[model samples]
Target chain A: MNARKRLQFGVAVAALMLAGAAGAAPVKVGMITTLSGGGAGLGIDTRDGFMLALKQAGDAASEVELLVEDDQQKPDIAVQIADKMIQSDQVDLLTGIVWSNLAMAVVPAATAQGKFYLSTNAAPSALAGAGCDPKYFAVSYQNDNMHEAAGAYAKKAGIGKVFIMAPNYPAGQDSLTGFKRFYDGEITNEVYTQVGQTDYAAEIAQIRNSGADAVFFFLPGGMGIAFMKQYAESGVDIPLIGPAFSFSQDILPAAGDAALGVMNGANWSKDLDNPANATFVEGFETEYGRLPSLYAAQGYDTANLLLSAMSKADITDADAFRAALAEADFDSVRGKFSFGPNQHPIQDFYIREVVKEGDVLTNKIVEPVLTDHADAYAADCKM
Target chain B: MLLVAEQALNGLQYGMMLFLMAAGLTLVFGVMGLINLAHGSLYMVGAFACAWIAAATGWFWLGLLASLIAAAAAGALIEILVIRRLYSRDHLDQVLATFALILVFSEGTRWLFGSFPLYLSLPPALTGAVTLPGGLQYPLFRLVIILVGGAVAVGLWLMITRTRLGIRIRAGEADREMIAALGVDISRLYTIVFALGAALAGLAGALVGSIQSVQVGMGEPVLILAFVTVVIGGIGSIKGALIGALLVGMTDTLGKALLPGVLARFMDASSANTIGASLASMLIYILMAVVLILRPQGLFGARA
Candidate 1:
């Protein structure tokens, strides 16, 4: 009786231990973002913000494993990292690319391979439209949303003639198109500069002579900082307006007082009035010793969304996990976050004014520009 | 008309900066016969040094001085440690070695300064615009840059024509073996020339850093333009570099400013802007190709 009972008990315990291990095994997430070169600020913020969310979750996030890598802001390197993450690392989800060009190179392929991709920053229109995949979700707004909001704001202000400028790229083209879609005013001039251009003296001279009441531009990262400084020094006092990419926390310090009084379109800000946002802004500062940009907010929300989905459904159940992610049951710092038809965010956009909060330059929400905004290409998506 | 005038001034300012970069590159190539791709890394070193010192000391001028010293020192160190070995090697070896140095310098910088860009502000005195003829307002700092470039050009001309060191540099450029045979202390001269060139590049970086973001890899874009300037000006001619830089700068700036307007006369504004910008970016290269076709030895290059 003793030998038979002892053998059965040992077998039962070993089976139970194996079952627990399978159930509690962490969900693997691969983050491929720029962490070197000129664009590292955005990627560092993304990684920090995502890690912050995981840290705050503490015991609740015990079942999550994160693997982070730098893409160096290059499309080829991003593609290579994506391939490695999917094939060798076998991560359940991939996220954290800062540039649209890199995202375009990596996202379609990764999603096609049946891996879920939660975009932290880049939300290219191509991926939002006919290229949309059920396996991909953009936690941030569409690339056009902020520019479209700027256009809407210009329209609301009744600006008669506006000068618009952007870099010569797909996202840049989308920026101007989005602005024109919402504003019915006369465009005094439409200029497209070389991508990564540092000098804007020629553009400023044209803006001064164009008889435009306001100027709109969309130059992100280092390009934006350069243009803003040069524009400020050029003394073209025409009111400057743009998407928040140029005026985010990451850029504002480098731009210094040059960014003061500029109005920019954004979906979130540190001064946003919500419990979740307040917690996020304060937590980010306390954790990273700096203010969080909208990119950081997006990264935080992406991680929280994954956590919520994990709580609702097991990662092994693809359909259930997709449905759970679509639910977006997390409290987003952006307030009232929800996915549109194409799985891109449908959210309110606001006009933010760059002002000095103490010694630090930061943005504050002045007013709402677009209410429950959705991308124009969502109708083209089949799923 | 005012817009055109303003753009021309902009072009002049841009050309001045390019001249600073190309002068050093041309000198190094002419005297050393070495292709140094890491010249841009020295420029970056200057910008980072300026930004860091300026932030620490709260004095922009002090930062500028630091940029020069830091870049010159870095240049001399590399010359002694790495570049000296490459002098006897082939051009491919030099290129490979310098290219590897770029990676090393970039990673080392990232390690020291972290990844985010540093801010370098213009002093209050040069912060505002000055009114020009026809009511055009231009930045005072840019005018300063133009003045500084002109002064340097004059200074370099004087040195080349009058100084003993300049004569040695010229002689070295003409025949390295002859200069060495004459007991010119060739390695020391090479180090000095390289450092002098690096100092020029560093000054350009510091001057430009106030306007642009002082981030790692910032020098690469300007480096490409400097290479273009060198090729167009003849690889070894300082005067040629000046003229080529201005030509390239003017072509680039004016093409960007006027091409869209010209195209808008025939096409819709959006398509005109898109197509015109694309064409404008290619304008400088086009100019270079035309110059090469017209003068195979470059505008000022000596015939082989």
Candidate 2:
């Protein structure tokens, strides 16, 4: 009750207030995905991965306020979501996009605003190359990395000639260009169908006539199912191959016996043997009541990577957070990962085959395609 | 040669499927004088019902039957409950109202089916491929689609031209009040016409679903294309629908298939590739615009 004692108590209370403001304020992060359309499964999985990673971190993430939005798979809407998140939410970071076009549309705007954009999916090559910016970091591998791995695997398997197909879109072109990077053999035919096209009989006939040893494609979502069914019915002797997105767990159930024996390359499969991955797979299944796709895995990793950066940055400093993300010093379910110079992930790629494992359908890893394969266009990025 | 034949047949089958969808949209517009943007929702419903029932019953045929019935029933219900309110409204209001229906139906279906797509397989009878002359093999299911589409076209033509209901429908199109004054029970006729349109859409959905994943919103993009088809063919003309559907489908398929090759012959591969892809994608839309310019009303439109 002395004047000196009262002044000391007031100073102590002021110090406590400053410390609480510095360490306890939540790190607000914004995420956007397609939660209401044809691509909803991918979006839902991404959301699950993100939230699961947060759950695993427990109360530690209580200091992180994650704001999520559904883009409805529209590019314009994605841009709007990105804008709203940055301006209204005042988010410190941004992540989550399943489609390449949506990512391409949103990433640049986020980066221009000096916000860190950690892409969970939509690793469009432009973003890896000329479009690359320091503020943008991909939590997933570059869009073409998996396809390039597929091509390399096919060459390793001694495949002489392949027929390739994809939707006639920017991403579809990326799929072919990536495959051709490592595939030195002859391409008997390269076909690009309409984006939402359902019929594949003509393409199947063309492939059969082309006399290719195998067929590689980049038809994701409903397009994949249609092509596989038609390919099966067409009696094309060629084996089918692609990245896991076209025919993974989201698609395999629909593909059924037709997709059996199809080869795919990916960064994560349910059959990956890493302990961190195993825990993730089990936890994801327990939480979501379904197998997690690569999209989900990437989304989950984005959150973990953000956390790693947040811890390194003490949760507030922008420049330090950006540096920590670029360092990518995090234990991921995809195992240890680091970012290459372009802020695109330099990670392992695995060759996997569609197979029925007990009562469940999943991809079983066949072999490692590459260890930390840096994307081809990283030099073009200059970032 | 046989390969070309097969491709052309495939194109024709696809065109016929387009006709079924376009027919429903055109009929609803022509008769009701209302824009129904949720027609595709009915198509989605048909596919989902077919897929769900097929899985539950282990019968593709039964599923097809159920899809048609379900789609038609849904069409009637929607007409009575929602569409009837907008009959006298402006086209823009009708468009907005139906657009809202699209949101409700799409969300409702997603809630029921979850996000994962459902696969509907062909029956064993339609699974095999028969070798055509010149050593080209074609899937039986595609041939069946062509056959079924053709049969529907013929059956539709007969029903419209040869039946008592057909006369009333044509009369209603010319003068709605006149048909009503003649005691033709206009409300019942509207419901029947709407149901008929819905049935065609359902059949198209079921057929296409066997080939594609039956997923929510799958019918939307196609529905837009169907509208383009009717507009190009001449709204209120079944004959125009067939012509427009085939023309649109072939132009779309063939332009996409051949554009890159043609461009590659004259230009550098990369430039040709880029230009060809863009042009190929835009071919049908370009065709639509040209038709609109040339005919104004449409190539087959009946100028009132």
lDDT of 1 by residue, B177-248 (tens): 998998989999999999999999999999988787687888888889998898899877889899999998
Q: How does the DockQ of candidate 1 come out?
A: 0.60
All candidates' lDDT scores?
Answer: 0.89, 0.83
List model 2 lDDT by residue over B1-304, tens digit each: 6656766777787798899899988888888887889889888888988998998999999999999999999999999898888988999999999999999988899889876678888899889688876776888887788788788878878988999988887887788999899889988898999888998898889888888778788889889889989999987888788899998888776665567778877874445756876786588889889999889878888863
- Candidate 2 local Cα displacement, residue A170, angstroms: 4.1
Estimate the overall C-alpha local distance difference test score of candidate 2.
0.83
Second chain TM-score for model 1? 0.97
Give the DockQ-based CAPRI class for model 2.
acceptable
